[model samples]
Target chain A: MTDLKLALQEQAEDVDKVLDDLLLEPEGPEAQVVKAMRYSALGGGKRVRPFLVMASSRLFGVSEASALRVAAALEMVHCYSLIHDDLPAMDDDDLRRGRPTCHIEYDEATAILAGDALLTLAFEVLADEETHPSPSVRCALVSELAKASGMNGMVGGQMIDLMAETRELGIPEITRLQRLKTGALIVFACKAGAILGKAKDIKMQALRNYGHDLGLAFQIADDLLDVEASEEETGKKVGKDAERGKATFVSLLGVERAREQAHMLSEQACRHLDVFDRDTELLRAMAQYVVNRRS
Target chain B: MTDLKLALQEQAEDVDKVLDDLLLEPEGPEAQVVKAMRYSALGGGKRVRPFLVMASSRLFGVSEASALRVAAALEMVHCYSLIHDDLPAMDDDDLRRGRPTCHIEYDEATAILAGDALLTLAFEVLADEETHPSPSVRCALVSELAKASGMNGMVGGQMIDLMAETRELGIPEITRLQRLKTGALIVFACKAGAILGKAKDIKMQALRNYGHDLGLAFQIADDLLDVEASEEETGKKVGKDAERGKATFVSLLGVERAREQAHMLSEQACRHLDVFDRDTELLRAMAQYVVNRRS
Candidate 1:
């Protein structure tokens, strides 16, 4: 196995443990909501966002405990978005990661409450002093995460995506949509370590730039996969964007041009990492992997 | 007008302004969600929760700016809950505040996204340094609010309420449900002033006792309203508990007994406030008002 893949596995396990400890079931009828929270949040996905947090924190010498807490909180937010997206009123998909969606496994109301609970729990975990000794750091984390995930960010992006079904969008409009929808949280994950460490302005800027280029490149690759990968390999209903007539990167740019664009963005992302003096090979390799990986 | 009513009216105005300022119109298609959020969160209800925060904050001399910010954040959470509750899978109500519900006005997707955005924005408001000069106080607000509204609190209460539609619940079980659903946030509101001031343990305990009794009394009064009030008087659907065969205070204890219980608890809540020597008339009157008010 590759070194990056092994490191990602270790980080994913660490985040899973934290998530398990945080989502304890209560001894009441209401424990059903927590059960749903546990079901969707546990044992899912590649944990890419958490891995980004772990990798970035390593560069700053942040403690494993603190970094894991932030990673878990972020993963909770991501999982909540997915659960909401799969609801009957939203994308209305039955399957996610090769299993029944939250609303399919549980009732719609339970799934809604579970999504709400997960979102609420993310803030709770970030606010806890155990995440950081300094209250300032905790407050900063809450502030940044809120901006990235709220109306002006992920939710706002979703509104635009829904509107896209009825309207036409150009390249610039699509770029803005993807930036808010998916890029915002990815950038947050990459920059979270610098925020925790209170690093210098130059280092923070470098990570921010790297995250911007990497997030767009990653989304383009995801669009490419949606067109090419099968449902069995992707563990989801593939070709969904095209089926829904959504204007993804590949649809607008065509496969060849879009693939080339992703490659160029990946190299540009790697170039931003040169600001760091050492120990950047993992982050650099991640840029290339986003464009090259299958499924 | 009564002094308590006057104070509540004033506090509501302050909170409304803060909410308006926070929810700006973004120049994008995503602005539709923000519009929905503003519709549901602004210009409605008695703003009783914000009134509680303002009244409590006055006791400890917390700044008006700080108090208003917390009140607005609390109201955002309250509004978000109302939006979700009125969804088809939940309470399925078509009207709130004598007008179309959020989902009735906007599509289901927009309402869901708006609710999610409001929930996220509340944490951002609480974590801002403008809410308090000290990061510790901000963190405390975030932590306490999250606990009050998350899985084991308001959301849990909603879960139990949903289950009550199918099950037979006695007084103790119903009491637990009410405590989590509506009472927890009230307790937090009553105690927020003490937290912001870093009040002594004895003082915090006194407010807590006051809040616990007051919260239960408030819920009992609410159940009574549902039983007796008209749609025109209350600005919401009447007798939903009875229609759904859900157990409530009036359902379990009868109207006369529930009325007596509300009065008794109101007086008990007032007595707990005797810890403070002066300027508590508004709070004291609120205790009586909860039981005696017709609408």
Candidate 2:
């Protein structure tokens, strides 16, 4: 694989270790549920959002541990969203990442509780003083994640997506929906790292813009891949969007235009890195990787 | 209505007003979700959890406004649980408080998002500095809520409940489950008030015990009502436990024995309040109401 692929894999492994360590505890009555949570959470994935957090935190020359909790927390919130999103009432996809969804592996009720446990656990992880030394910083992290994950952010976007599936949506409406649904957490992942790294105010703001743009680009690329990539390549069922008649960027703008938009957004995201002169190669590469990713 | 009934009605009205004012915001994409959330949270009910928080805070000489956010937050978490519990995969109850449940009123997906929103909003309300002046105190409050609402707490208990419904449960096992599921948050409610009010450590522990015992008693009484009360009187469908074939306190301990257990638990809870030299009249009255109320 390329150096970029190796770096992504390494970061994914590191974040996977962080997730496993954070999820461990002595036995309890609900140990089974905790085990179920770990089963879903620690199952290997790309770990893109956590990587963004770490990469952004590195930009400000901060220690990796300071952002580890936030990184894991982002993954927690993301995993929780995926768990719920894959439920029968939501996207109803049985397979995710080459495996059965949480609800498919566990009962739906267990899946629901597992998702709830993960979401609440994210706050608990952030609020732990041993993990996050600064109360203000912890609060900031919590606020950011809450805003991204809640109705006004990821969940709101999801509602719109659900509605848009039943009816055709224009480009503007689809973009707005994807921005909230998929992009909100992406922006949050970068902001989480920026907060932990204590980046300069101007740099932080620019990073926010970068994340917002990258998030949209990432979703567009995902939409494009859903239409273009094979199931084996994507590790997700291909053409399910078309089957459901969902309003995705590719569905609205076609594969060609969506690819162009992803490229443009990636450039916009990389432009924000110019504000930071130190250790930005990873950030720039990540922006490129966002659009170039096959899965 | 008696004097106690009149007082409860007034308290309920005041809480509704506070809820309306707190949830009110400018119209936007989030407005509809927020509206559904407010509609689920603000309607008529006992508001027992918030009352516990408010009354306990009063015991420690905190202003109502000081505890308002905590009160509202406790209610939000409670409402979220009810909403999720009413989902198709869970208990699938159609009616709550004499009206269609959130899932019944809205689609299951909307109800899911609505519950998720309320849970996130609980933390947002607590984090709002206007309501909670001390970041440290707010942090503690957030941590406490997270613990109560997460694994080894409410969610854990719910999982155990779901599992136990398929089989028999001994008294100790039932108590343990109830303690985590129902009792943990109730205990946290009282303890959170003590923390916010800056009460003495000894008082905090005592009030926590009080809340814990009260939670068990309250749950037992609920089980009793499920077996004995009518739908009109309780505002919930009667004999749901029997219909669902779930093991409740009444199912395990039988009706008379469960009532005796509830009485014993309430007495123990009231005994904990003896550590504080204050008018715990509301506390005592609430304990009595728990056992005696038909609905």
Candidate 3:
């Protein structure tokens, strides 16, 4: 296996352990919600976002424990979003990662409560002193993550995507939507290391730029996979975007053009890592991997 | 009007203005979600939670601006819960605060996103430096609020409540459910003032004790109202508990006995304020008002 693949696997396992330790089973009538939380959160996925956090934090020499806590928190938010998005009132999906969605596995109300609890837990984890010795750094992390996931970012992007099902979106509109939906969280993950290390503005900017390009490339690649890959390969239903008439990067730009654009963006993303003199090979490889992967 | 009534009215108006200013209308495809958030958050309610926050903060001489921000954040979380709980898969309510619920006013998808955004915004507001000068204090506020609202608190209580629809619950079970659902947030509201003021442990304990009794009284009052009050008076569908055969305080205890319990709890709640020789007339009056309130 390639070094990048091995590192990603290791980071994913490390984050999974942190999440497991943080989310303890509750003994109560409401244990159902906690069970649902564990079901969705501990279910295996690529953990790409957590890997970015670990890789970015590694660049700044952040402690493994601290980075892992932040990664776990990020994963919690991601899992919560997925749970809510899969509800009957939203995307209404039955399957995620080849398993029943939270609402399908548990009842809808339980899934909703679990999602709400998980989101709340993410903030709680970030605010805890165990996440970082410095309160200011923790507050910064909380604020950044909240902003990235809140109305002006991921949630807002999802709102747009929901609306886009009825309307045709051009390339620029699709790009903006994807940026807000997935790109904001990616940018926050990359910049989290800088906040943890108290890196200078220039370094933070470099990571931000790298994350921006990489996130776009990643989304484009996802769009391509939805068109080219089967449900077995993707571990999710494919061609839902086309079925819904949703405008994605691939739908706006033809398959060949979208693939070319993703490749170009991946290369451009790697160029931003030049600002860091050492220990960025993992991030560089990640950019290539994100665009090249089938899923 | 009585002094407590006057104070509650004034505080409610203050919180409304703060929430309005904080939640600005967005200009984009996602504006629908923002509009839904505003509709639900700005919709007229008693704003009792914000009033509790203001009253508690007044005990510590906390800055009004800081207190207002915290109060607004608390209200946002409350509003988010209401929105999500009223969804088709949950409580399935069409009306809230004398108007259509968020999902009824907007699409279900939009309401869900708006709720998610509002919850995210709550943490963002608390973590902002404007909420507190010290980052540690902000972190504390975030942690406390998250704990109060997350699983094992409000959300857990909700899970239990949902489960109780199919199962019979005794007085003890009902009391525990109410404590987690509504009592935890009220306790946090009261304790938030102590945290902001950096009050002594004894004082914090006094407020916590007061909040515990007061929250129980409030829920009992709500249950009584549901059983006795009209839909117009309550601004929501009455007898939902009985309609669904849901277990509640009123169901376990006779109506007259439940009312008596609420009144006793209110008086007991006020007794906790004896520790504060200062101006606690508002809190004392609030306790009485909570039990006697028709809606």
TM-score of each: 0.99, 0.96, 0.99
Where model 2 places Cα greater than 4 Å from the true spot, the runs are A25-29, B1-4, B22-32
DockQ of each: 0.92, 0.61, 0.90
Number of clashes in model 1?
A: 0
Of 1 and 2, the candidate ahead on TM-score is 1
Model 3: per-residue Cα lDDT over B156-204, one tens digit each: 9999888888788999888999999999999998888898898999999
lDDT of 1 by residue, A1-295 (tens): 8998888788788899999999999999999999999999994788889988888888899998999999999999999999999998999999888889999999999989999999999999999999999999999999999999999999999999999999998899999999999999999999998998898989888888888999999999999999998888878888999899989999999999999999999999888888888888889888888888775
Candidate 3: the clashing residue pairs are none
Model 1 Cα lDDT, one tens digit per residue, B92-171: 99999888999999989999999999999999999999999999999999999999999999999999888778889999
Q: Grade the docking of candidate 2.
A: medium
> Which digits, one per residue and each the tens of the lDDT, describe model 2 over residues B218-278?
9999999989989999988888888878788898789999999999989999999998778
Error of 3 at B161 (Å): 0.8
DockQ measured for candidate 3: 0.90
Rank list by DockQ = 1, 3, 2
Pairs with steric clashes in candidate 1 = none
Scored against the true structure, residue A1 in model 3 reaches a CA lDDT of 91
If ranked by lDDT, best first, what sequence of candidates would result? 3, 1, 2
For model 2, what is the error of residue A58's alpha carbon versus the real structure, in angstroms, after optimal superposition? 1.4
TM-score for chain A, prediction 1: 0.98
Per-model tally of clashing residue pairs = 0, 0, 0
